[model samples]
Target: MRHLAFPLLFLAGCTRTADEPIDYDSLRAEACTSACAVIDTCDPDRFAGMDPEDCFERCSTLLPRLQEENQCGSREIIHLECLGKLTCDEFEQNEIGSDLSEPSSLDFDAPCVTELHWAVECDHKEPFNLDEPAPTAP
Candidate 1:
């Protein structure tokens, strides 16, 4: 009984606590991976000479900028969320990233993406918050 209690307590202690901040490193990595997977499948020819690796790396390198945009209350969270939910089917139906000839032109179009055409840049900023619910105390 004593040994059982010890293992159970150790496992519980290893779990995340409510006060901990969100790990943006892991969060961004996952988001980038997801978005890149969709692009690799649906828009393989998005660039003139780019492959899946190039696209994934490109998405990864934008993490810092994404974090900054989110911190600035650009609602980047929605963009990241939309990217994760992006499907090849949606890409085909909506003609997203469909234009392979114009590499320099903006062709990305998705319904889930919000404020993508905001004429103005994000100005006001707010405290960084990922908006996830706080974990309940054990």
Candidate 2:
């Protein structure tokens, strides 16, 4: 996501000699910040081990509020919600890969959110079997 600090200062510091009255850039940045924060906290971990359909159902109920609050847009939230519904391996293979990275603010959108949601989701989903299958002794 575009950084906001510069734009925020530019907008808030409009001066008598300033040529630009309104800083759409800052406004957009603020909106993005709000959006990403909403996305970040909408942790798929909450629904770990849940059935896919159920996870989607729960996220569907909650995301509208995030949209209304200007935390995220309606367009892409569904994808993240859908991804949240997937199992860890399912999520990793289909939605993301292993080698997890800190999620970026840019992930508020569909594709990236889907990826990041699932990447983190896998970590929270469940641990793999550490023990080998027991051998059958004749």
Candidate 3:
């Protein structure tokens, strides 16, 4: 995540300038931080036996992918940030990371659930397991 420190400390002399452009990457990173913090603290029962470090590490790798839209910069930063602000109760209610297929009560609209981006997927001979090492690409 790009730190605001660079612009604030070095360029702006510890103050922010109006003309400074917002870095979307940094915004996405901050969103991940907020989300991760909430999960690490607010959802103990949900994440039982999980290390907070693992959550931070996994979230760092995964959350940034939300910005990779088909159109250049089409995905808005606000929507991504909205997801970061999701409540622990809401997350628990959603039953994410589970195999359950019940329709969600949460509004996945522009203000919050603006859009769902599909991950890059492919047909593999074997299902990848986290317990085991990744299969070698052909």
Q: Model-by-model lDDT, in order? A: 0.41, 0.31, 0.35
Q: Who wins the TM-score comparison? A: 1
Clash numbers, per candidate: 0, 1, 2
Q: What is the TM-score of each candidate against the true structure?
A: 0.54, 0.23, 0.41
- Backbone clashes in candidate 2 total 1
Candidate 1: pairs in clash: none
The residue pairs in collision within model 2 are 35-71
Q: How are the candidates ranked when ordered by TM-score, highest leading?
A: 1, 3, 2
Against the hidden true structure, what lDDT does model 1 obtain?
0.41
lDDT of 1 by residue, 16-111 (tens): 555886565665666556655666677776643544337657655633445553443223443444444556786453344322234333243433
Say which prediction, candidate 1 or candidate 3, comes out ahead on TM-score: 1
Deviation in Å, model 1, residue 38 alpha carbon: 0.9
Candidate 1 ranges beyond 4 A from true positions: 1-18, 48-53, 92-110, 115-124, 132-138
Angstrom error of the Cα, residue 37, model 1: value is 1.2
- Please state the error at residue 90 of candidate 2 in Å: 7.4
Error of model 1, residue 2, in angstroms: 63
Question: Quick one: ranking by lDDT, best first?
Answer: 1, 3, 2
lDDT by residue for model 2 over 65-118, one digit each (tens)? 223312222222323433434444443343333222434422333233443343
